[model samples]
Every structure is written in C-alpha cells, then in structure tokens.
Target: MELDKMDENEWRYHGEGNKSLVVSHVQLSIVLRLLKYPAEDSENPPQTVEQAFRQVQNIVDFSSNVMSCLLGEKFVHSGEVVKLPLEFVRQLSIKVQHQRPAWRCDKVMDIYSGCALCLPNLTSPTLHQPTHTPTLCIEIKPKCGFLPYSKHVSQDIKTKVCRFCMHQHYKVAMGTWKRRSRYCPLDLFSGNRQRMHFAIRQLIDEPQNNLKIFKGGRCIFSSMDGIEDSMDLNSLLHHLRPYFQYGNNRINSHMTSKALLTDFIQVVVNALLSAGGGDGGVGTDRRGEGRSFCEASLFNKERSRHGSQGSPSDSVLYRVRQTQMLDTLDIEGLYPLYRRVEQHLQDFPKERTRLQMDGPYNEAFLEKLHKCPSEDDGSLEYAVSKVHQYRVAMTAKDSQIMVALVPSCEEEEDDEGLPGQRQHRDFLSSRPPAFSYSVSILDLDPKPFDNIPRQLRLDQNIVSCYLRSSCALP
Candidate 1:
C-alpha cells in the first residue's frame, strides 16, 4: 500500500472519504532499547526468536497494567477496560515488483503487531456501542529482528560446517559411506586424523552455543540469522496470488493469510490483558519490584562488582540495589510510560475519552454488572472480581502456536547406484520437515529481580494446556 506524505514521525493513511488513520512506525531493535540492557547494532541481540517473543509478550503484558491503571474508577462509570493488541504495523523495505521494476516504499506493512485499545471487556457498556468509541489510535514501534545480517562463511577447511544444511561428510576406509559420529570407529584416533576431535572443533565454532535452546534446542535460531524480511513477504505474496486478483489482473488479497493474521492480533491483546491482573510486573514479592531501568546488561555488569562490598547506608551502589529490592508498585517509574501513551492519543486528530478494557470473560462480567443497578444480591462484587480474574488469566485458549506440516521431499534415485537402491533406499530424502513457527504470543517477561516462578508458571500453563487441548487453533 502507498502512503501519503505527512511528516518524519508518521504516515497518514486513507480508507474511505474524509476518513484517515495515522500510523507511527518503529523498529524491533528500538523496542530492545526498552530492555534492561539493549544490544548494540554491531552486536547481535542475545535472545533467539522464541525468547524474543517471550520478551515482547512480557512487555505487552506489563503494558496491560498501565491499561488497568488508566481504567481505574472509569471501569464503573465508563464500564470498560482498555486492551492492547500487539499487532504493530511495522515499516520495512521488502521487495515488491511494481508497474516499474524497482519502485521502493519508505515503509511496507508486515505481520508484526503492537496496537492497543481501551474498550469494554466484551461487556459492561458494550464496545462499539452508542456511547463508547476508542477513536484515538497510536502506534509504538520497537526495533525487533526485522532484517538480520547474514554471516558469510568461507568455504575453507576450518569453516566446513554450513549453518544452512547438515550434509554428512565422511567415508570409511573400504569406500563405504557413513557419517562420522561418536559411534564411528574412526573417531578413536587422535591428532589430525581424529573424527570426534574435528566434530568438537566444529561444535565450538558454531555461533550461540551458550544461549538456552527451547524444545530440546531442535529449533536453534541464534546462530542462524533466519530467513530475511523480504523472504517472508515474498513467500506470503506467492501464497496469495494464485486465485484472488485485484485490478489489472494482479492478485491483491489472500484470505487465508488475512484470517491467520487477524487471529495473531487477538493473541497479542489477550497476552497484555493476561499481564495486567496477575502480577503487574511486580508481584507481592518486593524483589525486582523497585526501579525499572533501561539498562540491564552493561550497567549491571559494572555496578554489581562493588555494590555488595560497600555499606548499605553509605555506599551509593548498595543504596540503589537496596531500594530496588523493595516493591515496584510503590514507585512512580511507570508514570512516564503511561503518560506518554496518553499524550500520543490526545495529540491525535480524533476525540478519545478515558481508556477501558475488553475480552470474552471480561465482557460477560461487565454485562452482568451493567444490569445489576445494585449489589444487594452480592453479584455485583462477584462480577467485578470476575473481571479482575479475566484480566490476569492466561490467553492461550484464544491464541495458540500451530504446527503446519508440508511436504519437503520426494522419492529420488540414489544416482550413486548402491546395491538395492531402487526398491528400498536410505529414505533420507523422504523425511518430512516439521513446522517450526514463532507464535505471535511468545513467553512472558518476568518481573525484574523477582526470583519467584509464579509468572513463568502462568505463562507455561497457558501454552501447555493449549497443546493438550482438543480445540482447534488458527
């Protein structure tokens, strides 16, 4: 889609006549800057795709707390709670063939998400009603891993191992083909001829061996800079252009992709709602509840050295750490963040009232509250409590990670002509590749300095239950 000229910070888009949407785009790397310690452009972000998803999930969830705070007493009058759908429309330089060969757009919309809305919890006054319309919309851009740098490995002897593929490269003395593994006989030797020794060197040379791997580390992505942003867009376009077409015979809409993306947006919104009531990023425990700093890695590395040795009363470092050990909800550190988002909304051209929240269960409870003009039956208090429960509850039931299995291999002759090649072969080529995807709703970002496992457990239970459930997910 083409954008109209406005200013450096945002792109003003048009839908119907006199109606427009102003979108401010940011990079994923920029979001990393929000972390305790952001990585430099020269260095890679320490986390993998899955880990990054969890980090984003945490941030989205924590942002929900701000939404809850914004809702405040408004929940009773306005009868709503605001929710953020992490469906951030990111601008990237993905290749798209135009009427001419190379017309470049300063930005193109991707599958990334980060949109927030304060509406009714699927209930209360009822969202999109006669009185409530969250007209203001602001986009927060985080510099996530959009385009990654591809490592150029030399084909020399030392860099024999390729990150893209794992083709076996060993032969026995009798000309028999076999991979050199720990079980191989040739690995028993030492020095230059040792098979196991070479493998060990190769292992050490691989990038990101130190980082934690998920699911038995089968989906290792830290070393491999993943397929590029353009590749993802291109794949999406390729999937869309078969039947559906726009003007001039060019396919414009892909129904399957559009539906899946919509579902992905729900995943993010639910994640944020989940974060609000659970712990508010600082649970009952005082540890990790104090100050929230932008620097986590570099700053901590230096301060931690002398922080403990100094006296708590006299030493500045000790005082800082000691203060940090207390409750974070007691601090005003999150005030600026909340204010900034509101300021952006206020500056927008639309008229927006106080923020609110929304979701399935929240909506039902709000409906009950709206009907009960009094609390004589005690249902009003119970309904309000249910709203809170819905806020902190997990969202995995709505957003689930899916596994799509596609055929990646076909039967082929072993041209080398091994003895009974035609009838029954090694079957390596026929092996199917499992579907590995980055769930729109990743893991939770735990409260800083909090050693408690509660948040982690909540996040894990959501995913585990989804996997175990018979319900279908998009």
Candidate 2:
C-alpha cells in the first residue's frame, strides 16, 4: 500500500503510554503505533532502521504468539509492523504534537525510526457504527486483582493490602497524583455485580491514570497526567449523554442526567461482566455502594472469601485473577531468583537471547505454569521458570481492558415508524441493552527481565509509606 499518499495529516493522536504514541487514520479502520525514546540520552539512543524494525517485529510476534496464549486469543491482536518513511514519521509526529497531553510530551515520538505498528482501530466509529450511531469505548487499566497469598511475602501488609491500593499512598506523597483514587482492583475483580458497579463508579469519580472514556476512538474524558482540573463530572456526562440518547428519542427526551450516567456506567459494566459470553445479567436501575479504598482490604476475610467464590471461573477478570496467581512466590521470593538468573545470564551470555521474539516464556513454559506447581520447588530452574511466569502475570496486571459499545444493526427499523424508538424497545427486552459490544485486552508489552529489582524496591517503598501514614491503621 502507498502509505505516503494517505496524507500524514490523516493520522491523528489517539492516546499514549510511557513507551509509545498511537495515532489513528481518519479514513481507515487502522491505527499506527509509534515508539518513543529520549531525545538526547546517550544510553538509550534511537534504534537504527534494522534495530527499529526488529523491535516492533518482536512486539508483534510476542503479542501474537505468547500474550495471546495467556490472555484469550480473541481479545489479543498482533498488528503487522509497517515501516513508514522517516520524513512521513517526522511530519506525523509534528502534526500530532499539539494534541498530546502536556506531561506526556517528555518522550517524543521516534522521528528517526520509520517503523510503526499497524493495528485495527478497535474503537473506530466509522467502520464499526451505523450513521448517527455513536460508539462508546471504555478503557480500564485494571491493575493487579489479587493480593499476595505467598508465604514468601515478608510484609504481612502485602498479604492484606492490594498493590494498587498501597501504591496510591505513594503516588499522593510524591505529588504525582492529586489524591488517592477509591477504585480498588479487588472490588472490580470481585465477581459480584454490585461490587463491580461500585468499582466502576469509583473510577468514573476519579479517573486518575486508570479509566478513560472515548467517543468515536477519541478520548472525551480522562484525568490526563493525574491533574486536578480534569475531574469535571459535567463534561463527562455531557459527552456521554449524546451517545446514550441518539436513537431512543423517548428515553433521550425524558432521561435525567443521573439516569443517563447510570445507563452509561451500566453499559461498561455489562461489557465487563459479559466477558465469559452471557448477557451480563447485572441490573443498572439501583446503584450499589461499596467499601471505601481504606476499608476495602484483603485482610477482610469476608471480602476476600466473596472475591474468591463469587467470581465466575470462565470470566475475563477471573482469568486475570488466576494469571496474577503466577507470582506465588511474590516479589520477595522472586527477588532472589531474579538475582540468580541475572548472574547466570552474565556467566553464560550466549543463552540470554534464545527465542527472544517469543517473549520471556515459551509455550511449553506457559503450559507448565498453567498446571500450578503444588510446592515451593526452590531450585535455580524453578526460580527461572517462575520468574518468567511472574513477568507474564505482571504484563497481564498492567494491561488495559477496552470495552467498545455500538448500537446493533441486525434489525431494520420500520419505514413508517420513528427512527430508533421502535427498535430501542426491542433491544432492551431481556439483555442489558440493544448495543452490540466487544471487549479486547490491550498493552501486552513484555516487562523487562531486569525490572524485578525495581519492583521489589517500589513494593518496599509503597508498603513502608502506607504503614507510616494514618491510612494504614485498620
């Protein structure tokens, strides 16, 4: 395909992360994900053309071959690696510069590297929706779902408190976040519909880094860089009401803001709960309250019991919770193993990059992990094996769940009847809503082998700070 003729201007900034910038093609159902790196850093310089190609190729292959096996294959897409002209990359970078969040400008797009990842625009409204049918895409960064049950976990607090909750204190102390978000991963991971709804409500209340609302593949609401000014509820509701009201004229005319917002949140909740394939039988009429972040502790035995028992074995959240259990040794035990692996790798550097494109764990290794070892088999081989499993689990923990909702076009509206009024009633009979939805897992990048030590230190800091603060007291 002649990518140059597509007009660099057609590519608009979609969203970004610490490592890459994603831009969507206006007229096409695709997006180009570009890598990002330091501007003048000597240690981490721009990759050469060959290196850049291999890097993106590695990502594609790893996501396709490895992550797909861990997460469901239907939810994971390993897009093709496309090499753009350097000039085209440069212009596209410049064009989207103004659209990026201010704080995210630190690491600019790799203008020197021509390689880009071409992915299907999962949230594309033009391709996925009928005319005047607005599409709502909810991006949820559901952090680690389960607390450490490993005996090797030195800190009793780590066993009692989830990593995401403890990290909130650290974030607040660092001034990186304006305040602590009440959204707990445990609550979201809890299979109970009420708890899940409550968790999503908390996210909507304070989106900070974890939740984002997109309309037509463009970010309409998010707490960009954890800024205080981005928490405008009125703006979020305004953007959401249009999509909810577009077809059902009767509901649109009479729907209050409260009802509209509830319906919107229900759509997202329905998508998440239905991950196992049912119509997510959760109701949206009555709002469910939940324990505060401070009160929502894993130490609460009743809460923990419900989480373990209430969750569906086949659901996506259940799968993630199970994947998270790979860290059976926790970071405490994983650290020693990590050091051993590092030393061994240094001793035999030749084995460091074997099957590198397949990510840290191979299919055989992953299958063994899925079997769940019965004992704390402490050996160099065991450590090596579990470390890879731990890394894969970490990737799953940091991944985002993209829930896309578009009005279903299966039934044709009667020619003599109102546009969508008659169809809206038919759509809401027994299911959550008339909308057709899709759920996909995103951000499947492999964590570096060396990040284990950094995690250990961060875990220490988070636990220490939380204990020192007043929030730690039960």
Cα-based TM-score, every candidate: 0.18, 0.85
Model 2 Cα RMSD, Å? 6.1
For every candidate in turn, the CA RMSD to the true structure comes to 27.7, 6.1
Compared with the true structure, the alpha-carbon lDDT of candidate 1 equals 0.23
User: Quick one: RMSD of model 1?
Assistant: 27.7
**Candidate 1 local lDDT, 230-284, one digit each (tens):** 2243343343233223233333443455543333222222221222112123221
For each candidate in the order shown, give its overall lDDT on alpha carbons: 0.23, 0.70
lDDT of 2: 0.70
Q: Which lDDT value does model 1 have at 356?
A: 25
lDDT of 2 by residue, 340-456 (tens): 777877888765665131343446545545554555576556666777788888988888888777765556543222332111112222233466666677788778777889999
